[model samples]
Target chain A: MKKSFHLFYIFIVSISIVVLPSCTKQKGCTDNTATNYDSEAEEDDGSCTYNAETDVEIHFSSMVGTESLVYNQEYTINGRKVKFTRAQFYVSEIHLHQADGDLVHLEDKYLLVHGEEHAYSIGKVASEHYHGISFSVGLDSAANHSDPSTYAADHALSSLDPNYTHWNWNSGYVFIRLEGYVDTTAAANGDADFGFFYHVGFDEFKRDIDLDISQDLVGSTAEIGLEIDFAKFFLGVDMRTENSTHSMDNMMLAEKIADNADDAISAE
Target chain B: MLTMQFQLSKNINRLTNAGVIPAFVSFFLLLSSCGKDELISDTAYNLEIPKGFPAMDIPLDNQLTVQRVALGKKLFFDNILSRDSSVSCASCHLPEYGFSDPEQFSKGVEGRSGFRQSMTLTNVAYNTLFFWDGGATSLELQLLAPIENPGEMDMNMPELIERLSNNHEYPSLFREAYDREIDPFTITRALAAYERTLISGNSRYDKYMYHEKNDALTESEKRGLEVFNSSRTNCSQCHSGFNFTSFGFENNGLYEYFADSGRARVTTLHSDVGLFKIPTLRNIGVTAPYMHDGSLTTLEQVIEHYQAGGKLHENKSPLITGFQLTTQEKTDLLNFLNSLTDYEFISQTAE
Candidate 1:
């Protein structure tokens, strides 16, 4: 009877050791919304993985009045003929306003719009009825002053060949670059001979662009169309006297251009 | 059950007594100790801090390491950081010239002139603000300016990283130093680590002041020191402390019509216009053509500018109310400035 009791005690001890470890609970992704969520997981291990799909696509169209903006193509602005050789600007801090009043913030996302590049895919977001979209025309102070070399070569703020947006000497990013030829002559009859450049950047000059539009990402990708009119960018500036500003050199002109840039953007 | 447990314990005790289990445990401990010793030896780097100077505040993430300093020194002298491979940091900041260019404006890639004179790197580790306008807040950030400046290296940071990664030796060097691939974080940290090691404190002035060696300075130098500390000259007011700099931004009246707008470029304040960071007087003898613009060719000119109360700028320091110095006093003051040169620092090679 004693031998049988001892055997029973040993069996219980062995079973308890095996079962206790299992009862401690395994760690894994516990969030149901995550693509790699484990239903059996009792504790969240912060290993949640989500789908990297393009749920929202933002398209930009650069224009001068009713005409599509073409490089080196002459366009009339404020009764003067102007031709843009280059036009580029940065967009950052994108947030999508849902119909239910929840904001889907796309953290650390930056886009550099230049030339024929028009479409950008802001990766996977929760399926909802988005009512409006808001973004900054330039990088925030923290992003502007951050080391450009830290980013990957393919990133918008990379300081790579295609995106030489940083001012190394002054230590900040050039948010907007608009360079071209303008007819600064008194008669305004000759060809666009005067070279003009407005390289706008600074923490004070970052403009917020908000567009109220309906975009539903419930079934398919939500497409947001935006148009930027270049003519409206030169509303109050006289090319003859004010044709150049490197942002820091001419604060008044840079401020004027920044304000105009804000008014120029509209939701399509 | 009690008898069975006692028998099991006896068997374990026998194994321990027989030295089988004990030997295994001893071997494991020995292996771990050896690993720890090797790690300490490999990564430990002793920075020679000169006497009287306070211990430098090193970043926790980037502790001093021999491999990292070696990598930084190599990069500092390498022209590969430039766009055309025409210039290195040592090109403008020559070691012989006290890490300052003799030219008023240091030449960069394709011999393009920079706006301001190259500041001395001697004792730069102690500095909180960098550049004449104090644009950069840290040494790591300051390094990026020269590399990307169109007048300087003109090298795109991404391209430079790619180049370094592809190089035959840099990948291994970087791996050994940082235990990671060549990136901006490691590059900047390593460079800063090496720069911090450039300590210059064993000058004649240091011996006279810190060491209590009365004879270290000559009679003229001693009199010059008295003048420097005297309220009449007020030279020590801004150029105060052991490093001989308060590091405050002041318009020493270098110019009335400010071209660069000095600290105003960073602060955008009217009062900050024409104000530049006060440079250290250490190694001032060798680092000639002084001031932010390198307009003062000699120490005599600098003293004279101060004596004349500087060119009448609205934002000039009130301490610069002109003071007269006799001819003999001027010579003594000049001699005293020469005493700050650290010959041992400039000639020493990396161990």
Candidate 2:
């Protein structure tokens, strides 16, 4: 009788093991169209991602009057000898327009273009036929009000240096940086060349540019190169007269730079 | 599902002949059957958010628990968290003062003075940004500053972790709170959980605004509210949100020349010079010596500074242009500000 009881116990345990996992109703992505679709899924999982529909590589290539940006090299514009020692700015809130006029976007990404850093890989986006790219020159109000230290060390928001592009939560980001020494007629403090640092900040100074360039992103990654004309930075205003602007207090200079930021780029 | 439970019980009954005791198996079966899908932290105490307040943004990675909060409260009040065991988070931030220092500058270990005043932690859970200059973004990450600041606790994190690991009760408490060993992530998470619980919403102002209790404030306070909300005064322009601040940095026309760069120290933008975050005024009555550096002594002085305009600076907020105010208006405004104090909240302790 005891031997028969042991045999019954073995049968019961075998059935329990077979039936346990099936009882729990494991739900997962079943649709193959979904980016995270699970093939082995028995039930539909709510977690489905279609991020590939929005990913695209954006490139901002700095230039000076049809000349590719060569840092510290003198470029004569109008009548002033100018050379940018540091050229950096933020490109944020990239939007790609679909044929149906539906907007696909890359949200909360602040891509900083540092002259010294040789433009590292921005991001790998799923290739798709897209209309011209539209992006803001500076961080949006929401992204601007972030605490940098809260982000990872490698994050764009992390303050690399307090003296330059690593802006604070209060002041927002430096929308554009064109700092270099120029041949000045009058040396203010007995200096030969007058150094200029034009820094633009604040939400009021945000510039939006929508370029007209169509690209077929079938399978391979497509690069959206925006050539920023260095000469365009000094279009309306003379660099020799308005030598430096370091604050939003100078609304005139800030507005001038903001206007030039629109025509500063040509998409390809 | 019910049949699965019945089947599980039957299978456990059959396990008796395998030499396992029936009692232990039954207990295990019962525990597993009930709330097996629930998260581990769900078994702990739940957060009680006050009515009419925004939901607390707790990090998904660090959920609040009873053991975690209790452990954090103990750590916050305990001096042993400091370098020499002479100071703590509570040392500068007194409970009576709405978890802030009434002193102009908070003293650290060995009487080393901090550059900025200890801010009030009341309703801190609602803040998206932390500190006067907005250094740390999340509450979990905010603990690193004071613990490592030279003018603060000055406790090295590695040594602090070693000490906690070697402590008589910390290891066991950590294991209960977090099913892991003593580590920095667990430490900061516990502290953040406890800090998130410091909700102060039972004040007379909250009662009036949220509960529709108009009689909670006097006629003077009501008049003061009008003045505060008026565009001419522009007090609500920056301090407009539910928690009494947008938490954005503003120059506020503090000084012509700043010894402390404030936000400019981080952003390195000249436009950010002398800018400091707009602090919540929920418990402004208790948290005296206001502003980033605790420059202003009293509310009267602060209001007067606004009334007399302020020293002109490059990055000063344009809204800060001074307005004329009568003595009665000033008194009434002060009365309104005092109504923000939550009597019950100040008296309550973790115990």
lDDT, candidate 1, A47-161, per-residue tens: 9987543477788888989999998999988888999988888889999898888888898889898755778887667776678899998999999988776677577887664
Q: Model 1: what is its DockQ?
A: 0.16
Clashing pairs in 2: A28-A45, A55-A125, A167-B267, A168-B267
lDDT of 1 by residue, B25-117 (tens): 533443455354233444777998777887888877678899888888888888999999999888888776778888999999999998898
> Which residues of candidate 1, in runs, are more than 4 Å off?
A1-26, A30-54, B1-42, B348-351
For model 2, residues A87-168, the per-residue Cα lDDT tens digits are 7777788777766677666665667766554343445444567676788888887776554434543656654332235333
- Which runs of model 2 end up more than 4 angstroms from their true locations? A1-19, A22-268, B1-42
Among all candidates shown, the one with the greatest lDDT? 1
Chain B TM-score, one value per candidate, order as shown: 0.88, 0.90
Q: Write one digit per residue (lDDT tens) for candidate 2, span B57-103.
A: 78776778888889889899888788988898988888889899999
- lDDT (C-alpha, whole model) for all candidates: 0.82, 0.75
